[model samples]
Target: MRTVREANRWAAVTGALLLVALASSGCVALLVGGAAAAGAGTVAYVRGELQSTLDAPFDRAWTATVRALGDLGMPVTAQEKDGLSGRITARAAGDRKVTVQLRKVSGTATEVRIRVGTWGDEGASRQILEQIQHRL
Candidate 1:
């Protein structure tokens, strides 16, 4: 396990680097960063942080994410699609056109993979999924 001091130091360094990257490249850098973080999934969340949050029941995490995103602006969209597993989708009420998706992970009905986007919700589904996965 990483010590508190070590974690704090790394966080500070990360924050500084991120600020520079964002200032130079805009929020896409942040999206990429978040996706990178979320990519670790159930493994080491980072170099040392254990990803215990993802261990919760899929519904619990999905609910929490929906709530969190709702609080942030996105609201649930579609609940189902023909010939496919059910999906929990949402969108922002604002002009930005942000859409969010929570789909069941393969071979499981209880777990979900989340994705978000905008502009009629077309194309770039993977980026949305990566965005949610990286952030969470």
Candidate 2:
């Protein structure tokens, strides 16, 4: 009977040691995760120059502008080209209507042709197009 009791105590001690090892490994993994997140944050803040306007084609430039606008909380549903210029129409997240044009000119961008209104502005549209003109 005494031998059986001794064996049971040994088993309990083994289980306790395994738990401690697992807990230690968990703490080390958390430390590694924190370090990786900090590294990514540092890399994203690096400054860089935009490509020269002459280096980009009109189709690519217009596509990039539309994508940029989408990233800024606007979603483009339709885009069309007529001659060298093109038009882009997007609805903000709240379904606000916004329209902007792109002139294939290099060096600098030009003004916005129109702004129908903000989302559900009761038939009123604001001129946010001028500010985001570069963003297509």
Candidate 3:
């Protein structure tokens, strides 16, 4: 039989390998970053957008997003909200188009996706997400 120490070592190695695999696959990013609070969820910068799921209601998330834009000096160009989803379009520095979309996942969870410009701005997107998380 394997000793307790040997079993623990094996488990650690397995966990490390799993993490490495996930990281290389771009899945680990989804499980990392952000604060330890309830709504301090992880964020991922994929394609041309930054995405995150906050443990807050849709209304709250929407409000925080708007506030975040204001805090970042982004001017709102258009906005719409409904029972299940919301979208806010803004203009950032250099007149870059910034879009934030929110979808209701549950009563206490909402998914937020942000895109800056036609392509993407990872730094600006991250700042917006951080601001939203702060407000949440």
Task: Give per-candidate clash totals.
Answer: 4, 3, 0
Total clashing pairs in model 3: 0
Pairs clashing in candidate 2?
A: 96-119, 116-125, 117-125
Q: Which RMSD values do the candidates have, in order?
A: 13.6, 17.1, 4.8
Question: What are the per-residue Cα lDDT tens digits for candidate 1 across 34-96?
Answer: 565443243222222122224334554465555665555566655554333345566654533
Model 1: colliding residue pairs: 34-134, 38-134, 77-89, 77-90
Candidate 2, residue 45: CA error in Å? 30
Model 3 / residue 117 / CA error / Å: 0.8
Rate residue 54 of model 2 by lDDT.
24
**Candidates sorted on lDDT, descending:** 3, 2, 1
For each candidate, the alpha-carbon lDDT, in order, equals 0.47, 0.51, 0.88
Best by lDDT: 3
Cα misplacement distance, residue 111 of candidate 3 (Å): 0.1
Give the winner by TM-score. Answer: 3
Candidate 2: list runs displaced more than 4 Å.
Answer: 1-57, 106-136
Model 2's TM-score against the true structure: 0.38
Q: Cα RMSD (Å) between model 1 and the true structure?
A: 13.6
